[model samples]
Target chain A: MEDDYYSIDSILSENQKIQCTFKVDIPDMGHLDGGHERDIKAQSKIQLPLWLAFILIYSDYVDFAVPTPFSSRVRNALNAEAKSVRLSALVGAGGHWYGFGKIIMRLLDDAQANEMSDLLTKTFRDRLAEVIDQAQHFAALGPAGGGGQSGDSALAFREGLEVTERELFSLAQESAKKTKQWYESTDRLRR
Target chain B: MALPVSLRNSITPPELELVASEELVEIIPLISIERTAFISGAYGPLRPPNKAKLPLWIAMNLKMKKKCHIVPPDWLSVDFLQNRLAQETSRPEFSEFPFRFAEIAKLLLDVASDDIQNSDKVRSLLKDIREARQAKSRDGLQKIDHSELGLPNLCSMEINEIRPFFVRAMGVLTHLTRDPEASSRRLDV
Candidate 1:
C-alpha cells in the first residue's frame, strides 16, 4: 500500500528520479579536475526517479521521460477490460500508482501536454469508478445481521476488507483533487 | 494479497481486556469463610448471608461456585438497553456510552440471561445496535468524510471489526491535506 507515501508533492521533494536527459555540461564540484570531470555532453539520456526528475524538469535543467505507467500498454488494458481487471494488480504493476499518476498529471499540465493529461484523467476516472463498484459488490455479499457462527465470521472479515478497499479509493481520489487544486493555485501564483 | 503486511498487522483482532475496576455486582455469601485475600486487600472474616460489593470477576466466580447469588448491574435492565437501542436507530449520530457497554451486556446475558429481567429483549436489542453500527461504518468508509466518523458503542469483537477500517480511513485523510516538510516551510511564512 502506497498510503503512507502517496503525496505527489512529497514524492517530488524526495530524490527519486525518472528517466531524463542532461541539458548542459558543467565542471565537477569537488575535485575541479578535468580527469575527474570526464566531459559529459549535453542531450545525454539519463534515468532518474520522479522526485529528482521533477526538480530538474521544473528548473529547466533536464527533460524527463514520459511516466511509464501512462503509456499505450496501460491505456489498452483499461479500454479492453477495465471492469474485469483488478485495480490492485494494476496499481501493483507500478509501485506508486496514486503518487506517480498525480506527479505525471501535474508535470503534463506544466508542460501543456493537454492530450496526454486528458487521456490519463479519463482512464483514471473510469478505472476508479470500476474499483468502487467492485468494492460495493464485495460488501453486499456479506451477511447483513451476522447471526451464523462460522460462515458469518468469514463474511464479516471479507466485508471489512471491502470497506477498507473503498476507503483507500476515497482517500486516493480526495488526494488527487487536493493536489490538483494546489498545483493550479501555485501555477496561478507563478503567473 | 494486495493488502499490506502493516495493515494486516494493524487489524490483528483486539483482545478482551477485562479489568476488575468497578464493584459491578453484589453477592450474598451462603457459606462462611475466615478471610479471603486478594491483591487489593483481604475481605470478610465469617459470613453467611452477608452481601458483599464484589468486583464483577469475583462475583461471577462466587456465583459459579454456587456459594452466592449475584445481583446484576443496574444498566442490565431490559428497558434501559431497549431505549438506548431506539435512540441509536432514530438518530443519525451515535451518542457517547460506557466504553465496553456491549461487552458487559454480552457477558451478563451469557452468564445469567435468566437472572436478568427481560434478558431476551436485551440480547436482541444489543444485536440490533451492533448490526446497525456495522452497516453504518461500512457506508461511512465509502464516503470517507471525517465529520461523519461517529463511533457507536462497541464490544471487544465489534471494536476489532471497525478499528482497522477506522485507522486506515483516518490515516488517508490526515496524509492528504499536507506533507510533513511542507508544514515547516509554512511555519517560516
Candidate 2:
C-alpha cells in the first residue's frame, strides 16, 4: 500500500545500473557503451540500467555482477554498524537501496539472493529505531529544532537516509505535527 | 500515488479522533430537554442533574455550549494513566487500553478539561504514557520479520502511527522472499 505502479521512487531505483558481462556478441550494439566500435563483443562487461540488464540477462546475452550497492563491502559495513552507514550515498539519487536489491535478486541464485535479502532486511530493521527517534526529535524541535552540534549531526543523518526510510520519517513527523496541531487547536477552548 | 502524504495508506491522528468522537460517553445535563433523535441513534429525555449517555461529539458540542458537563472516560483519569504508564515502561508488551484510548483521551481533555479532575496532571501522564509506548513500539519493530508480530493491545492511534512503516517493510520482505525462478519466468512472459 505504500507504493504504486506510478511511484517515482521505484522508477528511480529501477534506473540504477547493474554490471553485465556479455556472453554473446551482438551486432550494432556498441552504441550501448558509447558506440565507439559499432559492435558489442562477447565477454565485454558493461554497466547498464537494471531494466536493460534484466532484458539482456533473460535473453541469454549477458550475466550480471552483483551491483556494488549490494556488494560484500556494503555487507560488511551493514554488519559492522548499519545505523551509521549512508544508505543514500550507496545507490545514488532517491536511494531505494532495498528496492534495488530486490530487483537485483531476481538475477541471483537462491543462496546468494537469500544472503542479500537477509542483509537488506537486517540493515532496514537495525536502522529503523534511529530513524524513528530522529523523526520524533525533529518533529518535536520543529523548524527551529536545529541547534549547534546535535542539529548538525541530525542533519547529516537525515541526508544519509534512503528513500524508503525518508518516507517513513516524513510520515512520522507529519503524524507528530498533526497531533500537536490538535493540542494547540483545542487549547484555546479550555477555559 | 499522486495524492498528498496524509492520504497515503495511513489514517491520521485527527481522523482517528473523529472516529473516537462517535463513541458514547456519559454527560450530566444542565437543562431539561425531551428525548432527541438523529442518524446514529436517539437518546435523552434529559432533566436537570441526570447523567445521560451520548456520543462524545454530541457531548463535546453540548459542553462547549454549556448544556452539559462531560464525564471523562474511566481510563482518562490521572491514576489510571499513571498506572498504565508504569506498566508501559516496565513491561515488554503493551498495557491494555481501549482501542481508541489515545483519540478519545485527546478529544476529552482538549474540549472539557475543566470537567476532568486533575486535568493538567492527567494530560502530562498521558504524554508520559505515549512517549513510553512510542519507545516500546520502536524497540519492538527492530525484530520485524515477514511472520507474525506479537504486539497485543495496541490502541488505534498507536497502530496508525506504525502502520505505514510496517506495510512497506512487509512489502519489501515479500519481494525479497519471492521465488526468483518464478519471477524470471514472469519476466519471460
Candidate 3:
C-alpha cells in the first residue's frame, strides 16, 4: 500500500515507526536508538521507520512487535462499537491508522495478516456510514456554521478521525457541496 | 497521471445541468423566427401562439428574452410530484423518476413558475420529493457493502452526491483487503 511512488499519503505512512528487534549484531549503529554506544547488539529493540524495517524484517535481520494500534484491546473496542473508537488516539498524531495497519499486516505471516486485514475491512465498513453522515451533515451546515451545528459528539468523532478517514470526509463534503450549489445556482425565470 | 481536478472522478452538478439542458422541451413562441441551426443541431421556426419543440437551453433563452412561454413538463405539476413524493416516502427503494429530474425541475421551476399551475405548491412538492429521495439515498449509503449496493432507481444528481463517498470508501476497503502474502512473494522472488 505504501508502494505508490507518487502518493504523498503512501510516503507519509511509510515513514511511520514500528517496534523491532535486531536479529543479529550490527556494527556502529547504536546512535539509532539515541544512545552513545558504538554497536547495536542482537535482540535489542528500537523503533524503526517502516521503509527501513520493511527491508530488515523481510530479510530476517529484524523482528517486529505488533504495533499498539492493532493490538487486541483496540480491536475489541472497534468490534464493540467501531464508530466511537478514537482511531487517531490509538495510533497518535500524524499516523494514518489504516495505512500503518496495511504495512504491519504485510510484515506478518499469513494467518496473522489475514486476521488483521479482516479486522481492518470490517472496522472500515462499520464506520463508513458514520463518516459519510458527518460529511453530509457538515456540508449541509456549510462553513458558516463554523461546524457547531452537529455539537460536541460529532466534533469528538471528527477529531478522532485518522488521516485517511479525514481525507474521505473532505471528499464526501466537497461532493455534497457541489450538489447543493448546483441546486441553488439555477437562473429563475422572470414573470 | 495528470488531469484537471475539476474533471476528475464524477461529474459535477453544474455539468449535469449542462447535460440536462440538451433535453428537448416544449415552448410556445410569442414571435416568429426562421428555422435555425446550432452546433448541438437545428431548432426553431418558432411561430407565435403555436408550441415548438426546442432544447431546454433554447427555451430558457427565449423565455428569458420574453420571446416564449416555456411549457412546464408534466412532472413539474403539483399532482404528479405529490404522487411521487408519496411513493418516495412510503417505499424503502427509490421511486422511479426521470434520470435528470432534479436538474430539469430546477431549470423549469426557476424560470417558468408563471406557466406552471399552483407554482408555489408545485415548488414545495418538488422539495418534498427531493427530501424524501435524499433520505432514502442516505439510508442506502449506510447499507453499502464492499462488493456492491443495489440502488437501482437513483437519479444522476443523487448518484453524483454519493459518488465521492462511495469511491473513497471502496478505496479504503481495497487497501485493507489487498493480498499481502502474494505481493511480498512477488516482490522478494
Best DockQ goes to which candidate? 3
Candidate 2, CAPRI quality class derived from DockQ? acceptable
Model 3 misplaced stretches (Cα beyond 4 Å)? A147-149, A189-191, B1-9, B145-150, B180-188
Q: How large is the C-alpha RMSD of every model relative to the true structure?
A: 14.1, 2.9, 2.5
Give chain A TM for each model in order: 0.53, 0.90, 0.91
RMSD of 1: 14.1
TM-score of each: 0.56, 0.88, 0.90
TM of chain B vs. native, candidate 3: 0.88
Candidate 3: pairs in clash? A189-B110, A189-B111
Runs of candidate 2 with Cα error greater than 4 angstroms are A1-5, A149-153, A187-191, B1-3, B147-150, B179-189
* Best of the candidates, TM-score: 3
Over A1-191, each residue of candidate 1 has an lDDT whose tens digit, in order, gives 23347744344334334677778764352132234545555676766666667667777877776655556776677678544434334433224444455456556533444445445444443443334434434333343532444355334433333222455544433333332232123211211
lDDT, model 1, position B171: 52
Task: Summarize candidate 2's per-residue lDDT along B28-107 as a digit string, tens digits.
Answer: 99987899998988889888798899988888888888899988888888888888888888888888999998778778
Each candidate: what lDDT?
A: 0.52, 0.79, 0.83
Off by over 4 Å in 1: A1-55, A64-86, A89-95, A99-191, B1-14, B20-23, B41-50, B142-160, B180-189
* lDDT of predicted model 3: 0.83
lDDT of 3 by residue, B128-181 (tens): 888888777777766665666678888898888888778777767877885655
